[model samples]
Target: MTESLNISIQFGGGAELLFDKIKKREVDLPALKKYLPDCQREKWTIRELLLWIKENLLREREELFLQGDSVRPGILVLINDADWELCGELDYELQNRDTIMFISTLHGG
Candidate 1:
């Protein structure tokens, strides 16, 4: 049987504008092995989550949300209400029911 991860995603600090003005969503992510055939890891990480968001959720201005493979400089990432940096950044493994939030610190002039 294939396993799936159910998690919460939130966008704030105007970041929701990039995601069709939606502030929160519940998502079901397929197993890494099934989602990415080349993936050797058994679990999903923040790195893969970013790619998933870009492909499935992000509406436009991808440059404002992603920088290379990670979030842009002005965006803050939180996993389960804690800073992503404290959770190993891109290497952080995702857990079922985890809450991931993206907040844009950049403001328009």
Candidate 2:
């Protein structure tokens, strides 16, 4: 069984394009941007991103429990740019060009 859904994603580059493919049921994680360079950081792949959604995001798990995990707003997922926890989390209703940005928030000096 395959379900079709579309969500808004931010961060520019290929995120927008990727969302289009997603709406068509194309599960190409970072479809648009296969490699997003970040100065001296490693670039994540489309495959990797999709895997993450299936492994974690799409997974039905505890709410607050994930808050303290590494995929939280400050560590993995962005609070403001990411999905709304109360709404549906990964299962949230995605619209055409909604806007989802993944950020690593931190409190450092």
Candidate 3:
């Protein structure tokens, strides 16, 4: 009885290199209802979405994209054009039509 979450994912500052060189994508994450009752929520949090991104969208070199269950250092995450840090970082709950962007600051190091 849950609806799909339509969101936009964008990679910039060379972060797209890790995503098959694609800079933007419109993705649909299934409703949290599909998860275990204990983990299910009214909406998907960034923490949960990160795992889903790693499993579904990441093409390779997970280590380069993630660190200890979160995005690696030197990478910037933005949610709906606002800094994720200001939006509670990983704890930010995502909503329909949300735009999540990842921009890597580390490149050619």
Q: All candidates' TM-scores?
A: 0.97, 0.31, 0.91
| Predicted structure with the largest TM-score when compared to the true one | 1
Pick by TM-score: 1 or 2, better one: 1
Which pairs clash (backbone N, Cα, C closer than 3 Å) in model 3?
A: none
Off by over 4 Å in 2: 1-8, 11-73, 76-83, 107-109
lDDT of each: 0.95, 0.36, 0.88
**Better TM-score candidate (1, 3):** 1
Q: Candidate 3: lDDT over CA atoms?
A: 0.88
What lDDT is reached at residue 30 by model 2?
38
Candidate 1 matches the true fold with a TM-score of 0.97
Q: What is the lDDT of candidate 1?
A: 0.95
Model 2 residue 91 lDDT score:
42
Model 3, 6-94: lDDT tens digits are 99999999888888999999998887778535674677888888888887888988888899979999889999999999999988989
Local lDDT at 50 for model 3: 87
lDDT of 2 by residue, 1-109 (tens): 0222334333222222323323223232332233332323233322334445545344243232134323344433332464455445544433434444543344347
